[model samples]
Target chain A: MSEKYCIGADVGGTTIKLAVISTEGEIVKKWEIPTDTSERGKHITRDINITIDNTLEELNLHKSSILGIGAGAPGFVDSSTGYINEAINIGWKHFDFGVELKQLTGLNVWVDNDANLAALGENWLGAGRGVKNLIAVTLGTGVGGGIIANGEILNGANGTAGEIGHVTVKTTGGAPCNCGRSGCLETETSATAIVRKAKEAIVKEPHSALSSIKEITAKDVFVTAKQGDIAAQQILSDVTETLGLALANLTVAVNPNKIVLGGGVSQAGDQLLQPLKDAYSKHCLPRAAEACVFELAELGNDAGVIGGASLVKQYSNEQ
Target chain B: MSEKYCIGADVGGTTIKLAVISTEGEIVKKWEIPTDTSERGKHITRDINITIDNTLEELNLHKSSILGIGAGAPGFVDSSTGYINEAINIGWKHFDFGVELKQLTGLNVWVDNDANLAALGENWLGAGRGVKNLIAVTLGTGVGGGIIANGEILNGANGTAGEIGHVTVKTTGGAPCNCGRSGCLETETSATAIVRKAKEAIVKEPHSALSSIKEITAKDVFVTAKQGDIAAQQILSDVTETLGLALANLTVAVNPNKIVLGGGVSQAGDQLLQPLKDAYSKHCLPRAAEACVFELAELGNDAGVIGGASLVKQYSNEQ
Candidate 1:
């Protein structure tokens, strides 16, 4: 009971999720606040500090009770130095993010990329809980991934170790991606990619249910495919195959214990997972395929905060 | 002089390279013996044991003067158990390799995939030395890669970590690889792939210099390209671009401090490296690219033995 807690903050473009987490990896309390976009994100840290202070006072906790603060931000973060190179939505560039937060709250601060933290969070307490090595793929607007090896986040030399979305599935020809690459896995597997594929498929097969939807969504594609729409089914099949090839290729390189699929598109569950696994098995080396299991990410939106807490916990242990 | 030494062995399809390596990683003495295939690889460990004993006796050293034996073999190796799932060249399937060696020599034996050890060797003392993380790619008959993270080999769930050649680069149509996949990085980057590309180009452009050579080799392609052969140059360009994209994709996943290019094709020197780097820079996220350097593998053929010795050194430290 006398043990200390740390604050886990997941900073997104629109909102910041925060949690009071026990050193033992449990979330004690959680809340969120709108991100302060005014002044180009200069007030964001100050707002975070105010929230932390108010929360401590409300819980009748002493300053000493909080060990540190860990924040997961959407950018290239130098985790060792807590520097964020760039985050367009939050308007941060070349900012010493950790220092600003520490200056406001007088508490230790740690920062890492949001996706990397999500991987860590999933490895720590989600579906990949017991696995020492895993790759967590988030399939939303963009395909994002985090790699965990030896139960630690793999931040590579430039803290971009787990950019799975950028793994090129097709080199000669495919859709262009935001990452300035063509044929990236993200261009095929992201929610955006799914909707695009559905829209394209509707044009090719006008009689398909997807043609009726004016604004085709990722969910609409999956739901239509489930209803036996040939166009939707074909789109899902193509995306799943792309996802499989990406995962299989990653498996060949890293050979993790598990591949955890997350993000908005992943909620399609068995419909998405079964085909992906089958394709992975087909593409992967038999030995690597036999041992690795593919599973849905369990943490969902909470991965960032939990992963932030895990980062703080790791740093505390190191200290 | 009183310090002990360990034996390092690199088992291959034709011959087994062996070295009496100092605990500090220097090759004290080295030699090789033809791989015994008559008894279905039953005598491999025995030959290794005899070689070690004879060398120790010739040096007037006692058994206590040696630490242990480390061996690197081609296959899916269970480093923890020293069991090889399959090594086609050695005819080993579900073989308990370490136990057989240990029973003969009464010394601890450690075995891992040959490429993985080569990566360890390079990471420990070759071009990747002083770097904590690296991915060593060998562009030989088939592309082989080893991933080193936190100064140790990353053995994935099935001990198949660092299998970079299998990374799929083309999804729709490409050359079929031996690993039951089409459009693998190996299909473009391997020395075999390079020769194949050149030969196909020669057939298409019959007047090109490549048509004169009866047995078009990878070195021939590089040399002819260097001599202003446009056909050969074009082939190299295509291959390097493919290599660059593949390496760039991998860099996005692991972000190692160094990417060490090894094997026969890498000997092409700047002709291979410069274009590869350019392609990598083009495909990679700028942040990851900034922190990673590409270098040629310095160890060459010696990498296997050295890496085996490194494994034993690592085990000794762990003990």
Candidate 2:
């Protein structure tokens, strides 16, 4: 008997990462291709099909050897119906990615919000492996979250259960968000916000090393703050405090056993986690604060791919 | 075969309501007793036992007909361990209400948060009936919440899943809350907050009729506002807006099929709901907002008792 395999794909704005994993979660082959999501929905679908076909061929596996295919995309998805309701960045609306992909490759296809897939991946084999209840927050260009309860993803009534970034953390409506909402958690703590706020601060404190840079990023702020740049440090502190406030609110509301932090900003590690933990404990209800455990995500960038692979297993079980 | 019955109790800070319910969801008989939770642990047990005995006697039923009993209390409860972790108002900590009640009455007992029980009751027989995914918010002295997903109460890993009152809607930390947190949803929209904010406004706007009142309550604020008191109306608008913001956050995060509003403040009806719906729609992602439906709770005060009675049936099926 030969090993069974499934194809996992993570489609992003600029590129698509594809991986073939064995039944035991081992990646047998991996590849990537530039995604032309801007051209048309058909072009994007064709690109995905080519990647899957090439990956399987390189691994000496036929299309028949694949069990199913799972893909994670950024947008509102009807996982049950396999429809992409709307993906603003990709310029797609109500696109049946699953049906089109299945017809293109003659394979079963499953699609969901990328953050949820990442959470599933982490829960199955990463930081949240042993936890029965967990919430994963990703701090990239924008903040995103996925919730797992009793070992299952909570998709809620409309497959939007874990849209945590849109949660309001500010009453003053301090910042504008792309989601057309004011004072969202994402507006305060996302990497984009951190960089934006840092650049704005540099104008006032021209003595800071950050002022020398043409453009500042969250990474620049982290490095400059570590070197004792007061402006950089202040911005970092603000970001962490904002994140902590959101964490406290989430801690009280969800009361998950573990909270796993992921995405680029999370790479700052303890610089982000320590202050966040302090603020979370200070603001949360005593019992809930005591019951929660916070940790850095272990899966790193590969979480999305691994999570996409895990979706095949999850969907199979559901069926 | 003999008819099966269960005893359901709703233990509030001021009163304990008890009912003998048949398996078919009928309240055969019910009674109420003053709760002396002031004395803490032992007194609560004695009071609960006496209430159960009296209710059973009034219904002309014997202990042999009782299948089990369930109680809902205002506190952080460890439903699995049958412990009331904390009841701030009652000063009860780490009290095993279920164990004591079972020992005294010789019946299997289950215990949980009162608000959660109310949600369960609503799901079983009230406005939320037939909806597998729903959240119920009760706006009384303090705001409370219950979450039901796929027909089961969402008691998070630590048995604190549905504490929606603590979800921060305001980033500025508007007012201090009883839970030692700031800017909690309860601090702005609860019945207590409605009255407190109204009294402050009445003092400033001395020309208003509300200024002549010796004391203001949530009911008084709603009534005075309806009668065209500027101070009262302003407070009502603030309360409705705050509640709407909280509901918008919840709707985005959970994407429940329906949100049922209950408790004293909800009695303001469309005066509160229309503004809340507008704010919620404005804040939520279009997809999630479109999928959600808001309604007033149908169970009223007896929702707790009915929900507590249904717990036996709910858990029995789980086992």
> Mind giving the per-residue lDDT tens digits that candidate 1 earns over B36-151?
97667988888888988898888787888778888989878998889988888898888899888988999888999999988988887799986877999999998888998766
Q: Model 2 chain B, poorest ten-residue lDDT window?
A: B166-175
Q: DockQ each candidate and list the results.
A: 0.68, 0.55
Interface CA RMSD of each prediction in angstroms? 1.5, 1.9
CAPRI classification of candidate 2: medium
- Which candidate tops DockQ? 1
Candidate with the greatest TM-score versus the true structure: 1
DockQ of 2: 0.55
Q: Using lDDT as the measure, which candidate wins?
A: 1
Instruction: Tell me the deviation in Å of residue A89 in model 2.
Output: 3.5
lDDT of 2: 0.82
Q: In candidate 1, what fraction of native interface contacts survive?
A: 0.77
Q: Measured by C-alpha RMSD in angstroms, how accurate is candidate 2?
A: 2.9
